[model samples]
Target: MWIVLSLFTALCEAIKDGLCKKGLQGNNFLVIAWAWKAFSLPFLLPLSFITPVPEYLSLRFLGILALGGGLNILATILYIRAIQASDLSLTLPLLSFTPIFLLFTSPLMVGDKPEPTGFLGVFLIFLGSYILGSSKPGFWGPIKGLFSEKGPRLMLCVALIWSIAANVDKMGIRETSPFFWAFCVQAFIASGLTLLLFKQQKSISLGSRKNIFLLSLIGLFTAMGLISQMSAVNIGLVPYVIAIKRLSIVFGVIIGALVFKEKDLKLRLCGAMIMLAGVFLMTA
Candidate 1:
């Protein structure tokens, strides 16, 4: 069940990315980022009222939510700037490091670790993702640039933050229901971004009917992805769940090929095959 939910979450994430790509033309980064959270409120806010609340809330839960939301906002901003700062081929490959970071953070923060086979699966997923993004400069160049370059360095920080944030999410979900926690975290993030936008004198106006509609779609998928992800993390191992979630990269490649007629399909397809093999090892 967790595996299925994780795949659904990956699908939702891939679709949201594609939609955001389409919507990114006229919109500023901050506004689109805000829309990713704000527009999801229509779907997410309702879940708060409908879902059963936890019997006992604790200070730890409140702290986890606050810390997780803050970390995520920072990660999101760094993520956006990383892409803007450097080439996609370089920065994106660094995202695979998240699972590796999780290997340490998981046991420390959440007191959980994957089996040896599952750990190997995580490593393979990282390798496959690196290959998927290693188009122009090849493997060594990107690997070498991980620290010296600004974008890769920023993305590495984002990965490290996400690794810790994942554990925080697991702790928060343990204290509250997944639905409620999802709503709370997202609401916090949306509110935080709203303030940041205001500080920058940026308006949240989506502008243009088509752009608005596209972002709405992004929001819808974002909500679905959030719910499914939190639910999966609640019951599944955090490292394994995150490893599966990175399947979004494979899905993104397929979507780009079929929908947008993007090139470089063969190389990425090979990488996807490697990722599937790793997932099999972990799930089997």
Candidate 2:
């Protein structure tokens, strides 16, 4: 059940990424990032009302929410700058490092210790993700770019922040219903990103040539993705859930080949097979 939810989350992630790519061109990353969560807020708000709210809110819950939200906001900014500063092949692959960081952070933060085999699966997912983006760099550039380039370093920080944030979210969910916590986290992130967006642009717009329906679709999928992810985290091991969610890279590859008519399917599908093996190890 959790695996199914995780896969759904990964699909939503890839869809949202594609939508954002289509709808958010030529906008400040802050505005685009704000739109990512902002539109999701409307969809999540109703869920919070229908779902039972916690009778008591704890300081620990608030602390975790703040920490997680802040990390994500910073991560969004750094991630944009990272991609802006370097080649896509150089920086994007570093995102797969999240699960590796999660292996340690998950146990330390949320006490999620998967079996030894799960660790191998996690490694393979990372390796597969690296392979997916290694087409232009031949692997050495991404490895060497970690220290030599600002983009890789920033992206690495984004991955690390995401690792910690995922665990913090798990802890936060334990304190409240998943629906309520999801809304809270979204609200918190939306608020923070809103301020940044306005400060950066002085005003927000839908961006040049962006379709309103397209932006809404991005938010809708993002809402579904987060809801699914939080639910998965509640019932499943963090490493397993995150490893499965990282299959978004695989989904992105297939989408690229099919929807965008991108090339290199042979290599990307090989990487996808490796990630599928990782998922099998995880769920089997």
Candidate 3:
């Protein structure tokens, strides 16, 4: 069930990225980022009221939430910037490195350790990432190209930040229901982003009607994806859930190829398959 939920999260995440990329066509990236969280308020806020509250809210829980939300906001900003700056194909695959970072973060943040097989899964994911980035001249050529580009580097940072945030999320969920945690964290992020947006742009206008509509769609998918992800993490191991969720990279690559006509489809798809195999190993 958790696996199914995580898969749903992946689909919603991929769709959200596509929609966000579309919204970025005409709107400011910050506006799109702010809308990504703010618009989701309508869908997520209500969950706080109906979901069972935690028996007690510890200072520890609040602390984790604050820390996690801060990290998440930073990650969101970097992720939006990375996507806005680079092609979907180049940027999205680097996100596969998140689970690799999690091998270290999960243990330290949540006291969760991967099974022996999981380490092998992580190795496969690493190899797949190398394949995805590698091309032409030689094995090292693609790697050099990857570092030479800004998008992949920004995405790599996003992946590392997300690994920490994911463990913090698991910690928060252990103390409260997934829906409740999602509501609080998202509300915090939205509030912070709103302030940031207002600071940058005098007012928080939705701009043209088409952008409003596009942002609204992005928000809906974002809400669904986050809600599903929080639920899955609450019940499953963070690493396992994240590994599965990384399937979003595959979906993102395919969407990029079809919708955006991104280059290097064959290489990207091959990398995605290798990563998918790693995800399977982690699950097994």
Supply candidate 3's per-residue lDDT for 188.
87
- lDDT by residue for model 3 (108-197), tens: 878778899888877676667556655333445434536777877888899899999999988888888899999889988998898888
In terms of lDDT, which candidate is strongest? 1
C-alpha positional error of residue 262 in candidate 2 after TM-score superposition, expressed in Å:
1.6
Q: What is the C-alpha lDDT of each candidate?
A: 0.88, 0.87, 0.82
Estimated TM-score for each candidate: 0.96, 0.96, 0.89
The reply for model 2, stretches above 4 Å from the true place, is 207-210
Q: What does the lDDT read for residue 86 in candidate 2? A: 92
Instruction: Say which prediction, candidate 2 or candidate 3, comes out ahead on TM-score.
Output: 2
Q: Tally clashes: model 1.
A: 0
lDDT of 1 by residue, 1-284 (tens): 99999999989999998888777778877788889998898899888888889777788888888999999999989988998888878998898889899989999988887999999899989888888888667767677887678998899899999999999998888888899999999999999989998888755565778888888898999999999999999999998888888999999998998888988878888888888888998899
Give candidate 2's TM-score: 0.96
Question: After superposing candidate 3, which stretches have Cα over 4 Å from the reference?
Answer: 81-91, 129-152
CA shift at 224, candidate 2, in angstroms?
Answer: 0.3
Residue pairs clashing in model 1 are none
Note the residue pairs that clash in candidate 3.
none
**Worst ten in a row by lDDT for model 3:** 134-143
The local lDDT score (0 to 100) that residue 62 gets in candidate 2 is 88
